[model samples]
Target: MHNEPLAYRMRPKNIDEIAGQEEIIGKNTALYHLIKKGHVPSMLLYGEPGIGKTSLAHAIAGTSDLPFISLNATVSGKKEVEDVVAEARVTGKVLLFLDEIHRFNKLQQDTLLPHVEKGSIVLIGATTENPFHDVNPAIRSRCGEIKQLKRLEASDLLGVLHRALTDQERGLGKQSIRITEAQLLKIAEGVNGDARKALNVLESVVIASDEENGETIVEDWLVDNLIGRIGLFSDKKGSHFYNLLSALQKSIRGSDVNAAIYYLAHLLETGDLVAVNRRLLVIAYEDIGLAAPHIGAHVLAATEAAVRLGMPEARIPLANAVIEMCLASKSNSAYKAFDAAVRAINSGNTGDIPPHLRDTHYAGAAELGHVGYQYPHNTPIGSFGGWIDQQYLPDKVEGTEFYRPVQAGDEVKLAAIYERMKEMKKNKR
Candidate 1:
């Protein structure tokens, strides 16, 4: 308002003034509990940008009456954290706020963990990525995670736009700017639920307005200016993680190996190495799965190597891993089969394990009518020693082969193996 940046000027000072995130800001929520009674926790706040992570950190700071010391994980290291912790000893209710904390290396992250664990500082950290995969285990283990969902509804962004236009000391009220319902709605929808983005776009309008008789109406030209001003190859990293991830996932899902590879390269080149680990591992399982079953092992191992080796040295391995991963010959029989089977189980048709398939490890098994469970390995077929009438998959589920392997590349061999196993198990009875 007073020549400050729109983001800072528009920041809410009180709980009621804070927008959205009612679930977290509510009295019974974790952050609210930490606030109301001053029960601050060593916690990680993760979500996309403009979802109130930073503002929530401030709300926590304000509620606790602590000397909130914040450091950028992109720049700060162990030395800085240690210095802050030492200063916090004399201070009462010390809270250390870490932003973009996923940027810290393992050793750097490792250092702050002990202090958080030992209660030296009530650590409140923020990240745009999933901390479970993004943060080192040492730091993540000691902290509680409060997931902040991205703004997805038009109403949510509208609320912020309204606040920004009306909030006297903070928003366009300082400049006496006004906007029509349709124009505001258009801007809100364009923001895609990002409150910061919505406000920023509004700020552009406020600055561009010519003060038409002292009331500002955001015109179409200004709207075009805002959208057109956003550069394609700009800072699309932190603020647009989900967007990039969606594009990456869609590229893979749509079977465009080149586009998928391009996304992976972008992700590895800029984002964390471990970010792709989980999805790649799943692709190995879901897409590759039983087809080239060993590919999962390769994908997982490459992720580990990338993390251990870090950048430059890690680049080739990451690229190679994802390349093999993308071209591993897709198949979703594992997913299709598992999903169908899960639907059956969840619908309460999960019949008990047949006596023949159960209880060989216990002591009283042979004594309590626990007999006639044949050992398939000792049979003539050397396996699959069960009879078809045995109902090994439960009477209602027998002979239900959910995983029908695809007739492509490696899956053909996998399908044959599954067939053989079914045959062997069928004869064992």
Candidate 2:
């Protein structure tokens, strides 16, 4: 048992023994009820890698004492799936754990539909990719539940490490290795919520330790040295990726240049140029909107340059863009106004286009009262330069104010001009 990797040897044999995902496996949770009743359904377990999707599937089968069959969709073909179905038929029912289910194409996924529907096979599919975007819709619909397993919390990972250290049959307990709580925590933190990675690093640290009188003492320095080799797994497709992206945008919006630059570097390290560019464009329009509208154009230019140049060199323009955005005055008035306008329209407040504001170029448009539209270009007001006091909105929304500009950055000048225009219009009225 010592020859096997610590992660594989310490696989939880029951639901109660599972380390993390309290939201999904805690008492009174849906998954908990399913396992307790021994009535496991077809479920799609989606989350980041090394977070125990396969282990949970095994635990579910073990709890029910049902026949369990495992397959990897990346390698399993039609014949392998047929064999599982045949075995299920003989056993009356079987728990089929298909890992990386997203790798299965449409036809491969379809093969399981009939058996799953017929109660011959209870499918427990696991995937890191989002099921909605990657899995076949048909197969997705058949899965009774789609439970999302979150990344294990730090404390939960610590418990897992402690368990491996004490379990004599399956873990390093036989080795008499002494490690401190703080040292264990270092391994937990370095893995970024991946228990398998934490266990592997712990095993390596123990194996490399110098033994004295059959007792191996794992010093902090030895753990630190081993940890340096294991890079933190940055899941570009998982929730962590979105969390980091959110942090970057919030940092820029909060005017923290250092934090914005740090997150930008992290994304660049992951080689997610497309996400970086998309997020920068969104931040410009959403966070720095109206206050510094010109930043949008500059952001686009930077994005273009980044895309053309690619990596190392691309980071220059991206860094410049991030710095500029972080230092600029932030506002969400434009975004808020658009959302408000959308809500009003969705609530059935969509008024008909005013006759004067309707299209007048097409033939017969004038017959429908589309004429008498005031051309602002032809009616310039004094000192206003090609501007005129005119009602552009429909009568129902004539006085509605959707855009309330703030007194920040370029919006200050815009607000002044808007107030001046309102005063001129009031006098004309």
Clashing pairs in 2: none
Give candidate 2 misplaced runs (Cα > 4 Å). Answer: 229-231, 235-243, 250-262, 294-327, 332-386, 389-407
Residue 269 lDDT (model 2): 79
Q: After superposition, how far is residue 403 of candidate 2 from its true place, in Å?
A: 5.0
- The sequence of per-residue lDDT tens digits that candidate 1 reaches over residues 40-148 is 8777888766677887788777777778888898998779977887777777448888898778777666566666878877887899877877777777777875565
In order, the Cα lDDT scores of the candidates are 0.72, 0.87
Candidates' RMSD to native: 12.6, 4.7
Best by lDDT: 2
TM-score, cand. 1: 0.58
Question: What are the runs in model 1 whose C-alpha is more than 4 Å off?
Answer: 28-30, 105-111, 229-429
| TM-score, predicted candidate 2 vs. hidden true structure | 0.79
